[model samples]
Target chain A: MKTSEDKLNEALRSALKRKFDDFGDQPNPSSYDLIRARLKQPRNYKYLLLTIALIAFFVAGVMIDQHWITTKSDVLSTKTGIKSVMQKAANLDINQAATTKNQLEENDSVKQSVSEPRTIVSSTSTKISMSSVVPALSPATLPTEQTNIVDAPEILEQAEIAALPVQISSISALQPESFKTTGLNLPAITITEALKSEPAIHTNSQKISWLLNLASLKTYQILTVPKSGDRNFQNFKFPSTFALESLGYKVSIGAEKNGFQMMLHYSTFRQRYSYEIAGDEYVVQAVGQADYKIVRPGTIMNEDNKFELLGIGLSKEVQWGGSPPRRSPQRRSPVRRSPLRQYYASAGVQYSHTLNAGPDIGWINAGFGRQFAINRTVLLNVGPYAEFSPLRLSGKGDPFFYQPYRVGISLGMKLVRP
Target chain B: MKFFTSNKYKDLTQLVRACQKHDPAAQTVFYDRYKSKLTGVCLRYAKTRAEADDIFQEAFIRIFNHINDLKEPEAADSWVKVTVIRTAINYYHRTTKEQELHSSLDYTELQLDSGDYEKMMDQLNVEELLSMINELPDKYRTVINLHLIDGYTHVEIGEMLTMSVATARSQFMRGRNMLLKKLEKKGIVHHENF
Candidate 1:
């Protein structure tokens, strides 16, 4: 026999059991079923179609705009410059030396060769003329036979007619023959040497000018100026400029150790100058400078000498779609495309700040990324992304935001068909 | 055992498949088949029938929404059970404060006439044996409910509650001792030989 207490406890247990048993027999109609039913209904097809169409339209527009901007800017800078040089050549008389000097100076190489006599010569003359100069100067007086002078006289004569002054500087300052052997740096006599040579001594200044004019015409032939009809010019401009500006970038023009630079400026995001260096090849640099923002306040300016390579060989035209057709003979040539075509893999360590409904927080991430062309117009990139942020330090003492570090994979593709 | 061996199992599987396809009739069948089990889970956490019904409905809704994430169809019973438990815990946490503040006014009082009371008393004799479990604390109530009614072992209970098996066993023994003491005080059942 049980006491009242024991009976009460037993009764309570039985009640709990009965309650649970009731649950086993009850029906559960889930709210999720209604939602799913609505989603699965055929009547929603029109909305689904409209959503898909809108997303497709957005993606198409972005791709088209990216292609347009890239092509336009590339033509404006690279193609236009090359075309102008070619046009100036076609209109001028090859017999005139004065015009030839003007044409040669316009070439970026000639401008860069201001300090070197050999670079000056190579920038202005053809191979035949360059060969003629080698024999005229004695081995002892000339820089070593790094540049063969078989045709040195022809180049020297033309330079003399163009009123270039020839200076006999010891060859010690010149780089070795192997260094000068690149496609752009051919051998020839400098203007200074030509001015002092026999041709200038024998001819009257007016006669010399006539001969210079004729030589300019021939010089034009060897340098292929980009033609006006070049399809690249028509499409490669706006996209490249737009791409940089959309990211709040401003462009700066100048020279760096590697070559001429077009830098992208972002004052708020980063104090450093990000630029594309265009010379032997295109390189991307992130240059650190003293806080010139304080000195020039609100003005975007180039650093005098602080440019360093963050990465290299980034071609605006190729990225933006103004890239010349893949099947073109010039495209096939390693010399013409090699500089811009090389792939680069880079690693960067960054500190990023994120502000959310919680507290402002900071994180550190180290990433390694590789950019390579799938074809002339498409680029693919993949990288591992890992970020570390302290949960305690994030979101202004909010208990709900306690998720710490996030790790994931990032993959990207760019259509560069220009 | 019959459910696993009989044609009803095949029918249940077919109903589940139809439910996956969003067939209303199949969903109704699926609901009818499993509703009782889910309701039982809900009742464990809810203080009243209405609350339990709400929890049961909500648990089913969550099941339908997240069914795609379930990798194993054979584990559906366990999966729904776990989901219901989690949902009930969440509900408890949310409503405990409100329930605590209104404990007095919300409490139900019972009244009976002498003759009716005698009949009731006879019925209560058996019920009283189980009702004493209500005097136990919430944690002990859950442990006793799981162990005695649901037939879960201490190790399994420990895993569900994220506690060690030994801890679950110790808590169970402690709850049993408390119940024994309360029964002795009420002059209910006397403990003699084990």
Candidate 2:
């Protein structure tokens, strides 16, 4: 007694209800659940082992520190004595210069005799003459050596006479005007007392050796010093290339001859339009250039170029804001102490998924992006993007597949700075 | 089903949490809820009930092992649906060539009354609806299944299938119309409504 239409509707509704109920009431195995549960035990065991290892490491570290302190004390004491002796030696040289000047002034006759520059007398004769005049000058004007000199006046005069020729010889060894004023008789004092102050003498030799070692350390060769010509090469582009050019940048390019090279120059606001292409396509011979400079010492900029091979594909050339000029192509180390503007530009094959009708379609994209800090934490990146794919052009059987192209922008950010 | 039988949605969440904590009872409870539904999903792509049962067990095992990869708990139903579909595709790839060799030979022939055909058609549910879909040629079945059952739009199906949106729409409509006619002739559906 149901109408045909009613029966059909009832059938459709019943079919839907039956589908929902078809899930059925039956028990199923939980093998995965069991495995997951079993996995927890091993994970717990791993954590326990890690904890025990860490505690053992910490205890070992404390024990090592205690042992290290005991062994270093002797070395520390020896260094302290050496340092004090060196300080005293330096002070002694200053006193010797003052005493020599006073002795010359007090005896004009002796000065007159010595003035000839050839009156080089024996150590005994010079000592008797200098000691007779020592009391004429104030104690302050005299050298601090007076304390030791008064105890053995004859020994002091003998030491001074013997030391005088050595000092004069060292001074005259200089080019004529090099020791014109304030010439401390340093060589004489340094050599004779060198035996008494062995620690100070050792310290002086060590200081000279340390300086020589520093000088001989492998220095970075001046492959190419930054020059005005480099800046001139960078100024080829206008400040801006497009409507939004105010947001763009101007870049310079220069090459050092250490390696095969090419250069690209462009504005930040414009397409990275310059490139040095050096080789053939089949057995492609080329040196690509993608270098950028920082506008400010520590700021970052978002700019880049897209490097695409005619046959292989596209690649990205990122221009970081703070990169120093490259003196050597092979050396990628940063010269500036602060994190030099970091950027990467690479040219290689790339792929991406695409949606199309008929046969499955995919895209090959070549592009690059720039990453730079807006602040300590946040960074901004932007670059040019291009995509290529094989598809129909117009009719059903076109000879050439449609190779659609798009030039757009890409943006990114760094969550952390390294 | 025992887990869902409690008639409290919160119980499902609690069971999932307990299972995550490695509780055996909770894991068993979680499996009971999804096994039958997953089995039916398996049956649609399988040639027999036994094959369907095997796929059902495999799918559950995979789900349990990879559950930690699921970012949103509430989306578990859709996640399971996609996993089952992917498993069916893998199953089809493995068995199709072997099955094709045997399909050329017929085991036996039997006479069937119109009543029997009608009875079988009457027993059809949504799972059977989906299974009948596999009977369609490859592209049409895939397009229609994606659009109707998986809830993908024509545009999304086009992207997935690498076809235009219009082509996806046309294929889906054609697949549905074919099912409507087949059901109508089997006397399971009355003429006026269809």
Candidate 3:
């Protein structure tokens, strides 16, 4: 204790304590007022995360929807010959039809057909006037001509002009024997050409062309366990009634032609509930193997979780009413907007493998909805949908079983028709 | 200088209880009681007064937010002190500006002298001593303050600064010798034996 080293340590400690024990003085009251102000602010991160996710998904949905609509429409107009049909229809004049008819009359078979009772209805008609064309055709020479046309392969080149007036099956009925001698089996091509030549028929057949729908729904999830008495599935039981969950959103793009559509959609749901799990570690195999440990046995877990599901589906929709006629600039009266309405029923399979160790769900969902047009291209769609999980694949030997049944009403917007 | 004895909430436990309830009056009194001591701790770790104020503000905010988790109210003084020190260290870790300053310092051995560092300590005023400490690189100054002034062991310093225990000890020795050298340059301590 009396050593110089000991004395030096004591002296240094005392010096430091003397200088900084109380320091010079307390800060001014105004200086620490800032801390007090900061303490009053509150932070709730759960709501913040939910808000950010919702906004991000909405923006992404809109951007993707816009992109697909633009790209699909552009492809339809350019590569599909629909552009040629529209151009030919818009440029339809009596002089052009006469020139085309005169061109056809140059053939020896066409001159013979003109001498017969056979009538060549001009392609100038916007509608598919097959009824008018059929009545003027000679029924006697049709079968014999069809047999000749079937044998001659070179005649298919002129199938477009030949099939213009009649139904595809009656291709030979409109032609003379000389034209039918160069036979070709081109029924599919003949049908397509028949539709294309008549722009009005083509436009009407392709109605309700493409639609983009954004939906918001209040969901109810029913959790149930299978009756199969497997010891590995004993931890969960079925709920007899539905529990109302939070709202979710869905964005879908469907391409419809001739009242049938193929739809691809993405939807998100937030499930919030409490359930008891037998506390133990278990391995279950779903899309891949997974290891999970539910905290101690008999522990009740409260969850508020969000997951996404991607699905592809096919649907049949029946539509009535037509888009309103464009108002002429000469008519000053306000044009009343009448929107087309359609009803559709769809069935689809949805799968989600990413739930952070939760069971993967494979659901078969059936939905029906009605669309009311908001304008020429946009519509409001509202409907009810139900999803049932026939298969719940878990990691191997997983004790927890989840059979999710979801029923909800969705209100959405449909954008753009072809 | 103001002392804690002048505050209305003289008992540490009573002050902590009222602060936990988020009472404005109790919070103000609690801050007044610990401001000088904690700010002094922050100043030793920080390079400047503005930096010290920032650390102090952040530390107090954390203290109030987590004060509800404290089981013993009487220990609020030591708890608040620990929080401030940890906050200052974290602040430095976040900034990472000390790497440049630490790299510039020369750690070459100086002339060995068993000078009377205790006698040098007596001549220097608090401001002069703190000024000399602040002049040292952040790495060495922090180790010196933690080891000598606060009396934290080398192992504790290593853990707090996320460095090896041997590094902490070396830093403290270098920082101590630097302070003695500063005192000698000031003509306050003459090495008669050297």
lDDT head-to-head 2 vs 3, winner: 3
- TM values, all candidates: 0.31, 0.31, 0.36
Give the DockQ-based CAPRI class for model 3: acceptable
Docking class of 2: incorrect
Best first by DockQ, ranked: 3, 1, 2
Residue A70, candidate 2: C-alpha displacement in angstroms: 4.9
* Model 2 interface DockQ: 0.11
Give the range of the ten consecutive residues with the poorest summed lDDT in model 2 chain A.
A210-219
Inter-residue clash pairs, candidate 3: A149-A183, A152-A182, A152-A183, A279-A296, A279-A297, A284-A395, A284-A396, A285-A395, A285-A396
Off by over 4 Å in 3: A1-11, A40-418, B1-10, B98-115, B188-194
Worst 10 residues of 3 chain A by lDDT: A147-156
Better of 1 and 3 by TM-score: 3
Error of 1 at A78 (Å): 18
- Give the alpha carbon lDDT tens digit for every residue of A1-418 in model 3: 4675345456666677667776643442334544654574345577479547545544554454445446445433433432243234334454554564455456537533332222222232221111112333443424333221111111222222233323333433332331333332222322334333322312233466666766665555534332222111223332234434566777777776654667777777766655454333434334535643222244555656676767666654444333454332322222322224345444555665543445566776655677665554556677876666776443223333445556677665555543
lDDT for A6 in candidate 1 is 46
Global lDDT scores for all candidate models: 0.39, 0.39, 0.55
